[model samples]
Every structure is written in C-alpha cells, then in structure tokens.
Target: MDYLLTEEQKMLKEMVAKFAKEEIAPVAREFEEKGIFPQEIVKKLGNLGLMGVAYPPEYNGAGMDNISYMIAIEEISRYCASTGVIVSAHSSLAVDPIYRFGTEEQKKKYLPALCSGERIGCFALTEPSSGSDAGSARTTAKLIGDKWVINGTKHFITNGEEAEVCVIFAHTDPSQKTKGISAFIVEKGTEGFRVGKHEKKLGINCTSTTELILEDCAIPKENILGDLNKGFKIAMVTLDGGRLGIASQALGIARAAIEDSIKFSKEREQFDQPICQFQAIQWMLANMNTEYEASWLLTYRGSLLKDKGLPYSKEAAMAKLKASETASFCADRAIQIHGGYGYTKEFDAERYLRDAKITEIYEGTNEIMRIVISAAMLK
Candidate 1:
C-alpha cells in the first residue's frame, strides 16, 4: 500500500498528466474517428523525454525507472489508448531491447535516434504461423558470406509502417528450431524490407498494424542482437517488460471510465435524484474503484520487482491479466451507468470499451497471460 514514489517519479507523473490533458485529450476523438496516428504528438513525447522513459540520458532518455515509465503510460493512455500503445510499443518493445541487448557499437548507432524519437522503432516477431507459439516461427535468416540474408514475414507488427528500425526475430539455424532463433536489428532502407497493407481493427484505430515483409533482406553480420540461438530468451524477457506497460495502459482505461462515470452519475437524474445517490449505482462505483486499486498494486508490484532486479515474470503476467480484464469490466459498467448516451460516438464510453478490448488481445493475450501465470505457479 505504501508507494513512496521518488521525487523524480512524482514529477514525471505530473508532467505527463498535464500533457495528456492539454494535448492528447483535446484531439483524441477526432484522430480516433479519422484513424490517424498521432505522429506529431508522438514526436512531442520524444521531445519531452517520454519515448524512452527509463533509458539513460546519454541515449536521449529520461534515465528513470520502470515505475515512472508505467505512470507515464497510464496517464497518456487515460486520454488516448492509441497514443498509449504507440509509446508502449516504441519504448518497451523497440527501444528497450536495443538498450538492453545491443552491442556497444549497435547501441551507439541506434539508441539515440530511437530514444529521441528521431526515428520510430518496432518489433517483428509475430508471424502468420506463430502468434502465441513464437518459438514455432518459420522466418529464416541465412548468414551469407558476410551479410545476414533474411526471408520471411511478420504479421500484426505495431508501428511497422512507420518504424525506421525493427528488432526482428529469425531462425539462423532452422535445424535448431527454437534454439536457432536469433534477434536482428534491421534498418528500414534494407533492400528487401517493406510494409504490408495496413489492417483495419476494432479499436486502437489510430495506430498501425501491418505485416513486415522481408525477402532476402541483407544486413551486416554485426546486426545480430545478443547471442546467436538466444533470441527466444531475448523475446520472452522483452515481453515480460511489455506486459507491465500494457497493464498500465489498461489501468488508464479503467481510471478514465471511472472518472467519466462519476461525472455522469452526479448530473444525470433519476427518481428526482442523481444516479450516484442510488445504492445500486454506489455499488457499481465501489466495485470499479476497488478493482482498479487492486490492479494498481499488482501492476506497481511488478514494476517495483523488475526495477529491483528481482524475478517478476509471474507478477507481470498476473498484473496484465487482471488489469486488462478490469479495464473491460469498468468500461462496460460505464456504458451501463450512462444508459443510452454511452452507446453513441458522442460519448467516450463506447470508445473506452472498444479500446479496452485490445488490451486483453495484444502484448500477449489475456489468455496467454493466464498460461504464463499457471506455468509459473506449477513450476
């Protein structure tokens, strides 16, 4: 229950909260309806040192901790889920890997641009054949003479269309199967790299989801990330951090729904009194608040354990699963509380519901989170 946040973390939360209110909230609806990625806002976030919240200043990062990063994501997501995902995917999936595993030369070459948002970054792991079974990926990379020649496709790649750099997984030794999988840093201008057609989705409409096409894409041998045949390990660890970010986003959705529901309940009258004054309405609000608080503790615990260099894979999964489901619950309850008004596009309640759904589906589905947790428990 004791958060005891450092001075820096408090400042970060306040700064991001203000920015979300003043900048993201005003345009969130228009952009979501238009299916437009908030590229300008993303750049502003980079300029504000949020694109790489926990990375070092030398790499153009804020040099903060995971808790600060989580708070930043939650606040931004409270306003715009699309933007929340953009920042999460860019920082947690893209930048963190390079910062964590890149060679000195590789870090020097990629980190500053990526961290500063001068060039956007994305991860390429999901494929047509392998979504949850990432180890079953069939993407191939042959080390030809000096360059690594890659041939395969990565589907459902967030930021794929706009990313300047990608942390891609491919099998260098197919005979080794999952063991052969290796991570690579592929630049956008590579000869055989291209973006597939964009996917129209149910929510998070403003973000891009496309296939990363690679046919004989050749890059320097030095581009190999981490050790050969260890990409699966790298990918798994990356997702652990990623789960925390998604959980925070889910928390944001729930928090936003609660704030809106309270505002509506006090103003919308029923039986000659406000809905909030009713016992049933009070129970709904109480349940939402209680679950939100519990989810926060789990989410913060995961981040705290991670920052302390302790084992937290199970904690991350638990937080992600609970928080994601909680988001959906709160969003649905918000609609129910609003009666007919919540169903329309004029209100953000429906948007929150739609946006909250994907939190369960991405960064490993809520189903996958359960699997991770059960496995951890059994082990």
Candidate 2:
C-alpha cells in the first residue's frame, strides 16, 4: 500500500522537525545528563499544539491526523527519546483513553488542561505485581456508596509525578478475571493518593517514572472510563495506538543514529582516508539506511491504518516489533562506527543505544508484539 502525506501534513512534519532541531536538540543531552525534567520546554511544545496532535480542536487539540502525529513524534524522538516518550505516554496513553471512551463531562473537564499542557497526564496500569498479565492486577477499585474507592500501587508509571490527571486501571472484581477490570479517571492531590519510589533509569530519565500509591482515593462514579467491567478492551485499544507512537519513536532514534554515523564517517579519517570511503563503513551505512526506510514504511502503515478507522492491532505490532529492533541495531552500528568515541558521554551515540533498549520493552514488550502478530496470522 502506498501512503502519502498531504501538503498540510508535510508542512506539519517540517514545522516539528525544525522545532526539534532548534529547541529539543540543543538541550536534550543537558537534561538527560542532569536528570532534570524540561518543564518549560514541555509547556512550549504544548503551546505549539503538539501535545494534542490528533485530537479534535474542540478539545484543544491540533486536529491533525494520526500520520501527522506520528511524524511529529518521529522528529522529536530523533533529537531526544526521553522527551519523545514523555509526549507519547501523555498523548497516546493518557489523553487517548479519555477522548475515545470518556463521557462528555469528562472530556470537557479534563481535555482542555491536558491538551493545553498546563496539566500533564499519565496512564496507570502496570503494577508491582503485574506487567504483561494486566488481568492479574492486584490493585482494586471498590464501589463505596456513590464513589469508587481505589486502592492499589502502580509502579513504573510514566508522567506520574508531573501529571495532574491520570487514567488508571484496576480490578473491580477478581472473580471474572480480565473482564472484571475497570478504568477510572483520578485527579492529583486526591486524599490518600501519593507518589513514591522514583527510579533513576538507563534511559528516558528525563521523563517522570514513579510509583503511584492510591489508598481509598475516591472519585465519583462518573469518573469511570468507558463501561464498567470492560477495561481490558480499553487498555488493548490504548496500547494499539501507543505502539504506533513508540514505533515512530524507534524510527526517529534509528534515523538519528544513521545520520550521526554518516556525519562521523566523513569527518573521522582512517588510513589517510575518510572512513565513508571504506567499503565496510559504506555497507554499514547502507544497511542502517535500509533498516530505517523499512521501519518507517511499517510505522507509517500502522499510523495510516489507525487514521483510516481500520483494525490495526496486527499492523501496530509489526511496526513496533521491527522498528524497535531496528533502533537497537542502528544504535549499536553507530557506536561501532564511532569506535571509542561512541562509548563516551561526549557524543550521543551511547545515549542512543541506551534509549533504543526500552522501546523493545515498553508499550508492550517486543515479545508481546510477536504474540499479537502470530495470533492474528494463525487466526
């Protein structure tokens, strides 16, 4: 299938690419090195209508298509994977559920601030006990009177600290397994709600990754997202879209690695010739370019399929699995091409390698993606 960007979409891509180069690229290493969150930068991005790229303008979104959103993500991730994921987790995971399944009241209440970037958002699903088996979540949401009292511990939560709005998943009834799970909308500073156990990670450290402790945190029954006892479906759908965002991120990182490799090969001479002239370096560059192109095609296909209102689980899985693997491959190759310099923090090659790893693991692991793909094929 041939996918093409409209004139407006091309303009959107160029705009984000320029912003990434001028804004994100300059401070990306600084923030990653210092482990400081770019609060001001995120606000700037939000002002540019990037935080709500694919949502309707009525909800304070840019009203762009999913392909345009993917393009924006790819450009930002090319400069900083950490910042890229911050936007992805917020937009694809948090804002998405509310927009897709929320009541009109919920949308009016939350989307404005979330889309404005004045209030960040997070998705709370993974717990200390659960990762892949979301149905086995130990966190519980009980109906007490007219309110839902949530009691659970969610770990590895992206944007946990910064988010004012959280879309959380919990088990309302354990007996029914996954079918008993439910989703809720919880605001920050609710009584008994607390952030805990902040982690320092190998990559994406600039993004807030914290544990959420919700003990008897009560929200009105109206806060229930989608329908009761159908959170599994919501989570799956959210993940299908999130995978496309992550796949775009992987493509961005791969592109960055390849571009860096090419620049370094031309400047660093070996045997009195620029390494770009060497067949070995040339072949590595060629392979990196090819991998990036292939991954882009898959990711764009998933994005296009999503915008077209098609069932895209298999396509999203394919894009995420290949693009994530290709990211790691390209980062590793870039490091090899840079030799010892790539091993140090003076250059971004090592950071690229680190950032590429988590793409294989999160938004559902590559292993999970493989299962999704295989199941569809077999069916």
Candidate 2 local lDDT, 1-379, one digit each (tens)? 1247888888988899999999999999999988888898899999999999999999999999999989989999999998899999999999999999999999999998888788999999999889998888989999999999999899999999999999999999978879999999999999989999998899977888999999999999899999999999999999999999999999889999999999999999989999999999999999999988889999998998899999999999999999999999999999999999999998999999999999999989998999999999999
Cα lDDT of model 1 by residue, 52-101, tens digit? 99999998988999999999999999999989999999999999889889
Worst 10 residues of 1 by lDDT: 1-10
The TM-scores of all predictions, comma-separated, are 0.98, 0.98
Q: CA lDDT of 61 in candidate 1?
A: 89
| Full-model lDDT for every candidate | 0.93, 0.93
Q: Name model 2 segments beyond 4 Å from true.
A: 1-3
